[model samples]
Target: MPVLVNSHPSPPLHIDMTPPKPIIAVVTGTGAQGRAVSRAFHDTGKWHVRVLTRNPAGKVAQAFQKEGMEIVKANFEDKASLVKAFEGAYAVYSNTVPPWHQSYTNKLGEYEQGVLQADAAKQCNVQLILFGTLPYVGPEFMGLGGVELYDAKARTNDYITSLGLPAVYISMPAFIDNVHSWPLVKAIDGGAKLEFVGYVVKPDKPMVFLWVERDLGPSVLAIAESFRTFGRPLAEHPLNHNVLPVGSWRGTWGQVSDEIEKQTGIPTIHNVLPSVDQRWHRELTKVFHYQNTHGLFPTDNFPTKVFSSLGVQYGTVEEFVRTKIAPMFRKS
Candidate 1:
C-alpha cells in the first residue's frame, strides 16, 4: 500500500465551481416582438438577459429593467455601440421596425441599420444570430409597388446569409392586432351592430395571423431550446439554422369572426372587404393578392413540434378575439 489516502481525500475541497449562465443580448428589444423575445429568454432563469435600446430611460425600458433585465444603451446607426453591447453575449436576437412606422427617418433606413447590426454581431463573434425578416413576393419581375417594407428586410437577409454567419431568420406574419391598429371596425346601423373587417377579398383565401406579443416568445424559445439540444453551436456556419416562420392561426377571416362569436357569445358578422380603404391600399391590396396566389409559406408552414414543449399559454385567433376584441365592443 503506497500510503493509502485517508478521510475521503479531504472531501474534494468543497468548492463552488459552478459556471455562470450564458448571456443573451436582445437588440431593439423593446417593441412588441422584441419585448416578447426579451421576456421569454429572461424568464428561463438559465439565460442572463440583456436588452439594447437607444433610449434606456424610456418607460418601456424602465419597465423591462424592473422585470430583471440588463438594459444597454445602443443605437442602430452605431455599429461600435452595438458591438460593445453585444460583447460577452452568446446570442443576439434583433428586430428592426420599418423606419416609416414611427416616422423616424426620411429615407428607408432598415437596410442601413440591418447591415450595421449584422456587422456588429459578426465582429463581436456572437455564437447565434437571430433576425426578424419578411420574404419578398417575386423574381424581380412582378414589380410589386408597395413591397419596400419586405424588400428592405429581404436585402438584409441576403447580406446575413452571404456572410455565412450562424443565423435564424424569423419570418413573421400579419399581426392579429392589425385590425385594431388599422381599425377596420365599422359601426353598423349607427351602433346597432358592429362589423370587424378582414383583409381578404375572397372568403376562402388562407391568411396567416399571429398575436406576436403572446406567440413570438414561445416561438423563439422553441428555437433556442433546439439550439441547445441539437443545433451547431460550434460550427462556423450553421446554414441549417435558416428561416423559421411563426404564426398562431392560418385560415379564412370568416373563421376568425366565428371564433369570436362562438367564444364570447357576441353577435357579429364577418365582413370581408373587397379592398382595404387605408392610406396604403395599393400595397396592402398587393399583399392580399400575393397571399391569394403564392400563400405565405408554400409548403405547410409553422410545424407545431417546435413549440409544443414550452409549457406556456398558446394563443389562437379565436381566443385572442374573444378575450381582446370582444371587450372593445359593448352589447348591441
Candidate 2:
C-alpha cells in the first residue's frame, strides 16, 4: 500500500536571475591600449572586466577600480603574478609597452614580456588570447634593416601564434593622436603656422591611422563578440580568425594636412624631404621605405566583414580632427 500525503503544492516559486558575464583579464591595464579595452568591456555590460597592473594604486588603476571592475596587481616580469591574475579569465588581452619608452635600450624586452604573458594565459587555460602586435619588417625585407621596433613586435606575433592558444592579433597602425605630439603642433602652440614634415614617402603616399582612445575599445569588443559567437573553431578561420590590422582611416600626408587646415582655419604647409640623413630620420626612413614599397598589410585592407557583422563603426580622420582634435587646440 502506497501512503499518499495530501501535500498541497506551495505557492509557485519566483526566482529571477541572469547568467554570469564572461570574465576578461586585461594585462597592462594602466596603459592606453589596456585601459581602452577595459572600458570597452565595461561599457558592454557583457563581460566582467579584471585589469592587471603593476601599480594598483596608480591613477588609472584607481579609476578602473572605482568603476567596480576588479584590479589585480601583476608585473610583466613576474610570470607567477600574471598566471595568478589570469586565473579563471575567459579571455586575456596582453599588450607590452615599448622598451625604449621604459628607458630600456634592449628592444628584445618586448618580445620576452609577450612570451611570458602568452605562457601565463596558456597555463590559466584562457579560451582566447588577444595580442597587440605589429607587422614584422625584418632585414629580409628590402628597406627595413634597422627598424627594431617593428621586428620585435613581429617576433612577438610569431611567438603568440606558436603557443597554439586560441589567439587574435590586433595590429594598430600610427595613431592619429600622434599629430598632437609632433613638433608641428608644438610650433603651432608657439604661434607659428602649421608646418609639417614628411620623410622618404611622397606627399601622396597613403598612411594608415587610428584614433586609439575612441576606436580601440570598440574594435576589441567587436573582436571578442565575434570570437564568442563563432566559438573556438573560428580561431582556425582563414580570414576572420587570425590577424586584424585596425585603422580608422587611410590618407596621404597632403590630405591629412588639408584636413587640418580645413578644420582649424589655419593654413598648413608640408615639406617632403628627398632623403633622410639625420640619425632619427635615417632610422625612421627605413620604416617609411618599407611601408611605401611592401605596403602595410597588403593595400591597407582591414577585416571589413568582421567589423560590419559586429556593427562597429570606425571614425574618419576629418571627424577625429573636427571633434576630438579641434577642441583641444581651441582650448589652448
Candidate 3:
C-alpha cells in the first residue's frame, strides 16, 4: 500500500504510436514500371511514395494524386530537377525508357538519362537504388550484335556500380504483357483465326517472360523493403550489388503460344518469320539467337528463394493469358 494511491496509470503511455513510413522516390512514376512499384508500396501502407514525372498534369499523374501519392515534376535530362525531387528520399527506383521509342533520342540518350539519375541519387544521398535493366548481351558473348539496347543499359549498370552507391540490379526479362502488342493478338482482335508466329529459335528453347504489372511491381517492392531491413551496413546483405534476373515464368515460345490457345479457346498455327531483313526483325533475331546460345541469367539461378522470402508468387503463363490476354479479344 506504499504508493498505491491513484497514480492515473501514467496517462496510458503513447508507446504504440506508429512510426512514419519511409519515403521512396519513384522516377518516371507514371510509366508501367514506376506505376507498378508505386502501387505495390502504396498497397503495403508502409511507405510514402513520391513519384517523379515531367508531366504532373498528365492523366496518369492526376490518377496517382487521387490515390494519395505525392507527384513531383522532374525530367531525366534536367539533373537539377532530379536532385530536387530526390531530396530527402530514403530510396530511389531508377529507370530510363529506351530512347529509340521516344522519337527524338537514341540509345545514347537513354544511357545519359540513366547516368544522370544515378548522379542525382548520389547527390541526394539516397540510401538505396534499384535499377530496372537487362543483361549486356552484346557481340562479346558470341559475335552476336545488334542488341544496343541491352548494351547501353549494361553500361549504365557499370556506371552505377562505379559510383560506390548501394544498388541492386534487377534484370527484367521479356514481358508477357507484350503478347497483346504482338501481331497474333491484333489478328485475333480483328476476327482473324489465331496463328502463332514462331521465331528463328527452336520450339524447345526456353524464354523468360514476366507479367510486368503483376510480377515486377511486387518483386521491386520486396527488394526495396529487403534492402531497408537486411541490406543496411552493406557487407552484411547478400543482395548488395547483386544481379537479380526476374520473370514470372520460363517456357519455350511454343509452349507459351499453346497456353494462350488453351486459355483463349482459339485454334492456332505456328509459322516461322518469312524474312528477317527489317532492322527490327534483324535485331530481334539476334536476341533470340543469343538467348538460344547463352542463357538469360548469368548463372542458372532464378532468385526463387529471394522472391519466396518476400512472399511473392508469380502467376503462370496460362493464368496470365486467361486473366490478362483473353479479355482483350472479348473487348474487341
Candidate 4:
C-alpha cells in the first residue's frame, strides 16, 4: 500500500490563483534532456523547480542546486519516497530512464519508474503534468518496436489518463543529438560517423534527420501551457493529441553527411545495416528508416504549431544546433 501524502477532499481541479511562482517538479532532472529543460524553466524565474533524484547530493543534483533548484531525494522504486517528493508541486515535467547497470535492451525499468511517478503525482494533487512519450496511435498503431521506450511511455499514458488528471503528452520523433550513439564519435575529434539500418523503400529519396536538443525546451513549455487550458475542450471535441517531429531540414543522408564534413571538417561516413551492429545504433537506424519511408519532415515552426497556439515560442533547428550543439564540437 502507498502512503498518502497530500490528499485533497474535493474534486481534482487546477486552482488558478495569482499565478504564484509555478512549481515544476521534474523527475530525473539530472539527465541530459531533463537538465536542459529544467534550466530553461528555471531561467524564467517565475518557476520554482524541484528535482527528484535518488542521489540528491551527487554531481548532477549539485549542479542544479548551484542554479537555485530545489533538490529532493526520491527513488521511484520506493513508493513512499516518491510520494514525499510530490508533496507540493503545481505541475511536473516527468522523465525516467532505465538504470545504468541494466543490460537489457527493453527498458522496462524506465517504464515502471514513470508509472510510479504518475501514481504518486495523482495522490499528491498535482494540477498538470508535462510528460515525454514516444509516438503511438493508441495501442493499435504502435511504432519503434512498441517496447522499451515506446511501450513504457504508452503504459504511462494509460496510467495518467486513468487518474483523470489533466495531462499534456508530447511525442518527439527523434533527437537530433542522437548522433552521440555512434561508435565512431569515440575515435573522431569533432565528427561522428553516422549509419542507418533497415531498407528505405520509398518514392522519396532516402534521407536521415537529426533533431537538435535546444529546440525541445520551448516546445515542451508550449505543451505545458496547453495543459492549463485542458478539459475545456470536451473529450469528444477533437482534443489535440498532436505529434511533433523535430529534425533539421529534411534532406538526403548524403546532405547530412556533407553538412557534418562542412561544419566539423571531420570526415563523415554512412554505413549500411551490415556494417553497423551496435544495439543503440541499430535502434536509431530503424527509426530513421521508418520516418524516411513514411516521408516525415521537420516543421518550420520553432515550437510546433499546435503547441505554439497555446503561447509557446519555439526555437529553430539551425539556431539551436548552431549555438548549443556546435559549441560542444568546438570545445572538443
Candidate 5:
C-alpha cells in the first residue's frame, strides 16, 4: 500500500546548499502535467520538489510521496493553505484546477491562485516562477464567439504580466497529443476513418503536436531553469503572447491519413473538405470551428534558435507520440 505525507512542521526547510539544487513548489502536483513537471525537477537531482495537493492521501498523492516529493495540502480557494504550501521555497511552478464546467469561473480561480502564490513567494523571498499559458492575442479570435476558454486564460495572462515578479510564461502549443481525443489513436489499432471538417490545404499547412499530459515534466523543468535566468523582466509585448510550434510539420489531411496507414498497416480514410455543416461530430466543434474559420490556429513551430538560446531543448511531437503516447494505448 502507498502512503501520503504532509511535512509541515519541518522548519528551516531543507534546502540543497549546492549548485543545481533549488527548492521549488509546484501547485496541483498530483495533476497530469503537474506531476510530469515535478518529476522532471526531481530527476534533475538539482531541486527538491514540493507538491501541493488538497488531499495528500489519495492515490495520486501517494504516488508522488513514493518519488520522495514533499506533499503539502494546499487548497486553491484558501489563501492560508497556499501560503503554507509555498513557505521557504526558492520558486513556485503555478498550475491549478478548479471546479469544472465553469470556464470563466475556473480561469479566474487559476489567476487568483497564481497571484496568491506570487504573494507567498514575495514573502518567502523566492527567486523565480514558471507559469503555463496559451497563445492568445486578446480579442484576436473573438469573432467566432464561443472561445470563452481561450478568453479566460488570456485574461489570466494579462494579470500575471502586471505583477513585477521574476517569472517565465511558457506559451505552450496545442497538445498534438490531443489527437488522442480524435479517431486517430483508435484508427491506429484497426479499421477507422480519420475525419476533419473545413478547408485544409493538404501537405502545406504546418500541424504542430504536443505530447500527452504525462510527458510535460521535462519540458516544464527546462522552462523553470530558463526563468531562473530571465528573472522578472516585463515582456515587451504582454497581451500579445506567442508559442513555439514544436513537433509541428506541414502536411495535408491525406498525408496524415497516409502516415497513419503506414504506421499501423491499416487503411485510413478521411471525409475531406466537407461543407461547414458536414463537419465531424466534435464535442468542442464550436471552439474548433471558430479557431479554424477565422484562421486563428494555435501552434508552436517557431525556430528552435529562440529556445536554444535559452537552453531549453523540448521534445518533438513525433518523439512524444511514439515514445510516450503510443505506450499509453498499449497499456490500455
Candidate 6:
C-alpha cells in the first residue's frame, strides 16, 4: 500500500573502522594563540585535539573539555611533564610565553622553555611542529639592544630548527586587539558615545593588523595541511623554511584611526607617546619602531591560493573595526 516504487531494498550498512584522526597537541593551550590554534584544528573535526595546560580545572581548560578536547595538565618548566603530554601526537603547536608576573618578559626562561618544547616534540617523533615566533630583533639591528619579548621567541625559533625537526615558524602580525587598551580608545565615562581613538605608531607607517582570533586558526589549518600533504605549500612560496609570515589587511595606524572614526563618527588621532620612559612603554615603542624602521610583515606570498583552494575566508582590519572594535563605541 505504501508508495515504495522508487525505492528498492536498502543497501546494507557499512561502518569503516579506520584509525582515528591524528592528534595535535597545543602546548600553552590557555593563551590567545593557543585558543586560536587549538580551535582551528578542533573545528575541522579532522584531528584529535589535545590541549596542554597547567590547570585542568581552570575555566579555559574546562571550556576545552566541553568542546571535546583532551586536556592534559602540563608545566613547561617541567620537561618530564611536557614529554609525557607530548607523546603520541602527530603535530605540536608550540607557543611559549614569558611569565608576565616576572618583569613582563623573561628572555632566558622563554628560550629554555622553547628548547624544552622542541626537545619534547623531538622525543615524541612528531611529524610537524609550529612555533609562534616573532621576527628576530637582535642587538645588531638598530642597536635598540633588542626587545626581549620578541627576541626570546626568536631565539626559540632558531633552537627548534637547530634540531632539524620538521617545523614552521609563524610570525603573527600586530594584534588589532590593542584597540581595546586604555591609551588607544576613549569613551564618555561609562557611556556608549566615542570620544577619541588613538595609537602610538607614526601616522603613515603601513603595518599588518591581524584579527588573530578569527584568522590565525584557519591560517594554521592551511599551513598544517600544506605541510602534511606535500611537505610545503603546493603553490610556489618565497619564504625560507624557518618562517611563514602570514599577512592580512595592509594599512597604517592613521588609516585605522580614520576607519574607526568613519564607522563611529568620532575624532581619532595618532597619539605618539612623548617619551618611552615607562618600562612597558619603552619595550612596546621599540616594537613599533622595529615596524617603522625595517618594515613589518610582507604579504606577497601569503598562500592565497592555498587559502582559496581550501575554501578559507579571512577577516579584514575594516571588518574587524566595524564589527568587533566598532561595537566597542565600545572604542572611543
Q: Give each model a TM-score.
A: 0.81, 0.82, 0.84, 0.70, 0.69, 0.82
Q: Which order, best to worst by lDDT?
A: 3, 2, 6, 1, 4, 5
Model 3: pairs clashing at backbone N, Cα or C within 3 Å: none
Determine which window of 10 residues in candidate 1 has minimal summed lDDT. 231-240
- Per-residue lDDT of model 6, residues 214-317, tens digit only: 88889878877776667553223332245766656667777777777788776654466644436345666777778777657554444345455666687876
Residue 252, candidate 1: Cα error in Å is 1.9
Worst lDDT window (10 residues) for model 5?
Answer: 237-246
Clashing residue pairs for model 2 = none
Span of 10 residues, lowest total lDDT, candidate 4 = 194-203
Error of 4 at 163 (Å): 1.2
TM-score of 2: 0.82
Residue ranges of candidate 4 with Cα displaced over 4 Å = 1-20, 99-108, 137-145, 180-212, 226-253, 265-267, 274-303, 310-317, 324-332
What ranges in model 6 sit over 4 Å off?
A: 1-16, 101-108, 181-183, 189-200, 231-240, 274-281, 298-312, 330-332
- Taking the tens digit of each residue's C-alpha lDDT, what string does model 2 give over 1-332? 99998699789888878877889999888677888889999988889999988778989889889988999998877789889999999889988766646322334477788888989998998888888887877687783454765777678778877877777888877667656644334235464466666667676876777777788889988888877777447556444437778877777767877777777666667877755556244545676787666556656554355566678788887887787656654434
Q: Relative to the unseen true structure, what is the C-alpha lDDT of residue 72 in candidate 4, on a scale of 0 to 100? A: 91
- Tens digits of per-residue lDDT for model 3, 1-332: 46666756567556767877889999889887888888989889889999888789999899989989999998778889889999998889998876645322434466898999999999999988889988887666667654766777778888998998888888887677766654445444456557666656666777777788788889998888887887358535788788778888777778877776676667756666643445344555666667666647635444467787878888887787788767755333
Question: lDDT score of model 6?
Answer: 0.74
Clash count per candidate: 0, 0, 0, 3, 12, 2
lDDT of each: 0.71, 0.75, 0.77, 0.59, 0.56, 0.74
lDDT for each residue of candidate 1 in 151-236, tens digit (9 for 90 to 100) = 67778888887876777888877777766666655457766566767665465667777787778877877666666556344344
1-332: candidate 4 lDDT, tens digit per residue: 98988665777788787766768888777765677678777887878888877778789899889889999987667668877988888788777665542322323376687787888888898877677776542333334453344556756777777777667666555454544433222224334532222233232454334343455666666555555445564232233333344433445544444454456545555444431225544544454445554444433433345644656544544554355434545335
Candidate with the greatest TM-score versus the true structure? 3
